[model samples]
Target: MKTSLYNIFSWIRFTFLFVAVLMIWALRTLNWIWMRPNRLEKCLRKQGLNGNSYRLTIGVTKESAMIIKEAASKPITFSHDISARVLPSVHNAIKRYGKNCFMWIGTAPRIHITDPTLAKDVFSKYDDFQKYYKTNNPLVKLFIGGVISYEGKKWAKHRSIMNPAFHLDRLKHMLPAFHSSCSDMIRKWEKMVPEMESFELDVWPQFEALTADVISRTAFGSSYGQGTNIFELLKEQSHLTLQAMDSAIYIPGSRFLPTKWNKRMKEIHEQVQASIRSMVNARVEEMMDGGETNEDLLGVLLRYNLKETQQNGVGMTVDDVIAESKLFYFAGQETTSGLLTWTMIVLSKHHEWQDRAREEIFQVFGDRKPDYEGLSRLKIVTMIINEVLRLYPPVVELTRIVREETKLGELTIPAGVSIMVPTILIHNDHEIWGEDACEFNPERFSEGVSKATKGQVTFFPFGWGPRICIAQNFALLEVKMALALILPRFCFDLSPSYAHAPYVVITLQPQFGAHLTIHKIKH
Candidate 1:
């Protein structure tokens, strides 16, 4: 009996050992096949592109994180030129390496292209350099979770169906929502102030609230209170997502671990998705039941998508609608809020420009609500807004993925490479914008975008190419509308408490709140 038991134990041990060896071999083989960087890095190196040679697994990710964290820790002097502070890692890499270089994020090589001509190609050619997952950050993909994830025919269809919602005529309909939301915010500011005297207030939260309010009212015909809650949830999700990127290192299946952050992130996303889904389904049902057709984004999308389906036998699904609505919340809210915030701060500093804008606002509308034509005619105001966008763009950077081995310019970009299309870096490039690139000058955009770039296709505060922001008109209108109300009603200057540290938490924004001293205009 003892001899028989011993034989069985030996066989069991041998079987377990065999299975472990097989599993290890399979994992290593998969890693080598999918995550190895020898061939592409070698090609990039041969082409004279500089940067750290590719390392296994983490691959300069840890070093890059250290560079970023260190940069953030040591704040710079009060200045608008935040290219270094905003993108220190990239800046450092550019210094250490040449202009055209490559870094690694896991096994993926990030080919940093700073040349404007090549950068232009990156944006114009959608297929060769496409946007898959941003920097291979799964958390970003999880939060973005929108049509941006799609490619080829699907992407075209998605863009097609959603285009009508942001059309010129459609945006005209949203003006009332914008006006009403901004009015409520200013009214509260009026109440907060002691009759015409100046008072300090952090306009950051106010702008945040205002944008959320406008998105709520315009997107779903919901009140500020309701939209505030949903926007807040999304805001939290984005914060957590960016934090996860900072805290967690790149690894296979790292996000799925049952860590506290992972769990909380998953839960928050679930809640956001659920809330958006409910809104989408209700709107779709209302459309089907022939109820009052809401003209807000949700309603228009339903109607527009219905037509698309009827015409081409294809349209955004219920989930597709949901993703878009969330995108509307994310991009629409974040972009407008940041734009307005930085505009207010810059206008505060450039008090001369602030006065000029008010003069233009009153000259155009004279205390009346701004119409689209009138707003369009406010050149000074538009210049100031454009300058603010150039100085402090909402989105600091855009990126694309090299899906297949592709040739852009002189270099052959290999598959499994990522591209960085930095908006701020290019916007502030002295070479492109001349000596006063870093200065706050609104005259650059006076003649229009084409004339501003001298027909180079630069000044893409709203991005460039076919994938240019659909909400550009909408956002510009909102800023025009918001500033028109605020400027004529009150004059503001940067508060003593306000810090000028611009940072990036997904979008370029003032790290500290934008506190300002507001003085009412005596009639």
Candidate 2:
């Protein structure tokens, strides 16, 4: 009787285990098949959005891929407007389906938010609407880490740690770094010119090098000299990341798959991390060896990190330091370069405004180097930069993913939806900026950005609300220094080869080049 009972119990256990496994598999299949699409469609209907009825499993992935492929194949043109090439598809969808519309890209439902009030709501509730796109592209993930990718407590902690580095006093101390970088650029340009005579050259690369130099000097101090080549490697890594995005949908563990591109990406990611790790280790050691705490950004950040570690005994790890350092390198370099390049392009086109800017620079400094105090006095120069940012924002679009069901304005945004706030569209909107919205006008920002947007959330070059860019002051200061040096030393005109194609590769950048004819200023 005992043997028979034990045999029956053993059989029961095996049967139960088999049933559980089958149930789990069924649920996973259902999630992929029915649940995801149903949720997406219901959310859109509730939000009063209209779009192509989502087809089975794949949804609109096939159509979206075709559009992206076409955009990629188009020949590069300097005169063609970037928005003109890409906005039609988006605009047509909105026109057909109304303002709050949904379009599928893979399994994701991209909800377009064009209304200023809706945008304001999305920007303000950033914690709820957070960045959620995860990819198999390793380099992209590493470079864009930190507060930009983080949400909730992680974001708050990182932001708190980084805030002190960009303080007003701290920026003032770093003015020399900016000056030194700009001075290097001017010297390079002077040598390129034939006996300092008029010549046409692409200014995009110059702006890039200047910003790279600034980030290197300010971020790593002596370490930048050692890590200069690594900066170039990081730039290459950025390009590879963009290429990786063009591939088909990536599943979990996709990077481990036996594809040549995947292997190359993995290698690059490893190399970048290795380089950053070495620099971070060296800096930590130098700080430990009785080195004076300098006021540069990296120095301040390291000192703060050390203090936090000592006090809490559970502070940021070496990996965290490396991640933040990469963030500083990419974000610091890209933003300043974009701002300076666009500002230069706009100032070149609008010669009268350029003259006013040069006049402001002359009146404020008079051929002398612009100090932090003197840069502040150049009101017209500041206005020109602000106007350029409004027209060609460094980040053309800001995205946030909804993790849980939330009400944005009157619409209920369901979980796993992407809210896209196109900064360029709003900035160039006729209703918002009047009839001459697209025109390059500095006077629009003369009274300040508040009046420029007509009290709406229209002008958000550095973003808006609680999650607004932390490095706005840092970027502005760098721009002020570069403009102060360039406007007084050289006059520039848009070259015939200059292209107006502004494409988004992490940041909005000239697709071809920013060609300009430069003539030395006569004293």
Candidate 3:
């Protein structure tokens, strides 16, 4: 009788476990479907926000894809006014619905925040929001691998070790490196010019080379010359990644499926890794030889990581060092170059500001090479660069995914919803900057960006808060140094061949190239 009772109890326990497993599976499937369309609409509606009704499982995916396709098909223009060009869909949605509205991007509801106060709130709670959107292409992951992809504890650890490398004092020490790189550019341009006549030239490549040189000198020190081929391969990889990104469907294991592009990308990645590893190995060997210290960024990073590793008995591995070095190589090269290219394009259109900036550069340095102190004193130049960043930000958009149920403003964002903050839209919002928001007016920055945004977090070319670009100062100093040298020595105007096609790969870049007419300034 006791054995019979035990058997019955065991059967009951088995049935209960089976029912719980079934319930969990059912809930997960329902969550995936509802989370995209139904739940997103309900959450927005609860907050008095209106937008297109989510359509079943597809949500807004079709509409978002259509917009991207259309943008890609159009011919590139030379206008720096991206807000005017790119705002039709977003503005139409806002016009149809209220200011606070949601739009669909591939079964994901994108909530648009035009209110400065609300934008501030979103940026303030950055940690709660992460950049892991559902549709992130695997190719993109391969290209932009580093601290940018990390969140929470991992992000904290990487950021802590990397922060000291970009401090202002270190950037100041790197000013000569910035100047040397710019001087190489100026010399190259000087050799290219035939007589005093204005000649049309593509400035994009020049900017690219300048930034590459700066990154090489500043980040790797003596190791840069050896790593040139690695930079070239990385640039090729960037182009391939963009091509992969344009395709919609990504099957499982597609990146390693032995396709032509995949093979090429793999080869490029390996070459870059090998180059970085060689440099790192050399540095380690040098450290072993009599403890001679190298003060460059790479050396500083290696030493710091080594010391930390020794103390903690575990820190960033050699592979970590290689990953980060590649990241710096690409990110540092692309960002500053893009910034300078756009700034040059904008300045060419506004020659008065160009002359004014030149005058300021002259007053600050007077034909002498720009130093850290002199670069800071050029407030007008700073304003011009800041204004250019607002109009043609290098990073046009930033995405954040909700890891948990989080409250943003009055809305409860369910986990897995990706929030995209379009920097261009926010920077050029008429409500925030008044009627002249779209115009390139450096005077807006006269009272400083804080006052300009009325204490809201509106202008974020380098982002805001803790996760802001680590190399903001480095990029700025490089720009100031380059402009201070170039503007005084040459007068430039937009080339007729210039096509103003700004698009995003890893960073926002000219789809064609920045063509400008350059005439040497008579000293």
Candidate 4:
């Protein structure tokens, strides 16, 4: 009996020892992955590029997190030269390692490509340098999780199916929706300033709501009033997401824990997906019933997707359609809002240019509804929008990763390394844009981007190459329509309470809120 007990104890001991050995091996493997410099990173260094050394798993994440927190704690003085404030980590890296340097975003060694030629190459070779699996936050996939997230044949198929929806004719058909939404906002403003003189209000949230309203109508065939619940939920989700991503607040594995925020984020995502599914299901039923339906974005997308499935036996699944709809809700609204806000803020600062824009608007539309032709003719407005996009773009950066060893220019980028196309930095570079690059000068874009860059591929606010934003034309048209109507109705100036602190969450925004004093324009 004693011998039997001893044998059993020995077996238990053996099992524990084996487990310990396995754990140590797994840890060593993980450490290797976390700290080992890839061939691409080595190659980059050999080619004279510089960066921070790789550390286990975290890399420069802790350092960047601390720096970003510190920067966000205090607002910089009123100015647009906010590269330092907006991306403290990137700015510090540039200051330390020069403009051409690498930085670590988690495990990925992100080479900062400031050269326009290199930038162009990165965008052009979309297949070679694939987008990182957007599950960066996991739930972020719900919002920007459509065609922008696809690659190879999947991307080709999705883009082909959705192209007709945003074609000039389709977008032009949606102009009345844009006008109606813009007019609704104008009416609200008219009521606020009932005396018909002037009023001081924070136009930031106003524009946010206005853009959200426009997107709701165009994207879902529902007005802002009708889609208020979805928009509210989205707003909540976004705030929660930003809070979760906050460098100062983030904790690994916390998202998996039953924390309030994690639970809430999951709940919101579920609700959003369910809402989208219901909308799509109802639309599909109506289409199946042969009932005429409003030709909004969802309607167009469904129609095309169904036609494809019937003809070719391949098309977007219901979930896929839901993803595209959610993408439209977020991207369609977020960017145009930023554009309008910054344009107004800048125009308010440069009253003369505002007058010029107003004069141009009058010259083209002249107390009439803005048509596509008139919007196209507003060269000055276009220039201002481009300059704003340069100075304060919606997305501050773009990133691509080398999944396998690939030669770009003189260097071979090894797999597992990501590269950053610092759009804001490239846009603000004096080397690319001359001495006045940082200055807000719409005149630089007078002859357009090609002429402005002297035929070099420099200005890429909507991005460059085939992977450029699909919704850019749609966003710009909405901006022009809203601005054309608003410019004639009111002339605004920055309120004394206005503090220009441009910061980035997901997109560039006026940190202090865009407070503008509005003066009703007299006929």
lDDT for each residue of candidate 1 in 1-523, tens digit (9 for 90 to 100): 9999999999999999999999999988667645467777778889888888777656477777777777777546766788888888777777789677778776677877778889889889998888755444565666876666677888888888788889999898899899999999999999987876999999888998898889888998898787666788888888887776664255668777898877877787788888889888888788788898899988888898999999988788888888889998988888889999999988888989999999988899995778888988999988988888888888787888887888998988877788987788788888899999999999888897778888775678887898888888989999999998988899998888887778888887778788999999887
User: On TM-score, who's better, 1 or 2?
Assistant: 1
| Models ranked on lDDT | 4, 1, 3, 2
Query: Which residue segments of model 4 deviate by more than 4 Å?
Result: 1-27, 33-35, 38-43, 133-137, 194-196, 243-255
Query: What total of clashing residue pairs does each candidate reach?
Result: 0, 2, 5, 1
Q: Write the per-residue lDDT of candidate 2 for residues 50-146, one digit (tens) a residue.
A: 8767666454665655665566455444432355444445655666787668776566678878799999999998778887553445545755676
The count of backbone overlaps in candidate 3 is: 5
Compared with the true structure, what per-residue lDDT tens digits does model 3 show for residues 95-212?
A: 6786668787655677777766666666667788876534456756666677877877777778888888998988889988888878878988888876677778889888988888
Q: Between candidates 1 and 3, name the one with more favorable TM-score.
A: 1
Candidate 3's displacement at residue 422, Å, is 1.4
Q: Order candidates by TM-score, high to low.
A: 4, 1, 2, 3
- C-alpha lDDT of all candidate models, in order: 0.83, 0.78, 0.80, 0.83
TM-score of each: 0.93, 0.90, 0.89, 0.93
Q: Given candidate 3, what's the lDDT at residue 447?
A: 83
Better of 2 and 3 by lDDT: 3
Best by TM-score: 4
Residue by residue across 85-203, what tens digits does model 4's lDDT show? Answer: 88888888988999879977665678888887888889999999888642356555544578988999999999988988899999999899999999998999998886668899888
Error of 2 at 289 (Å): 3.6
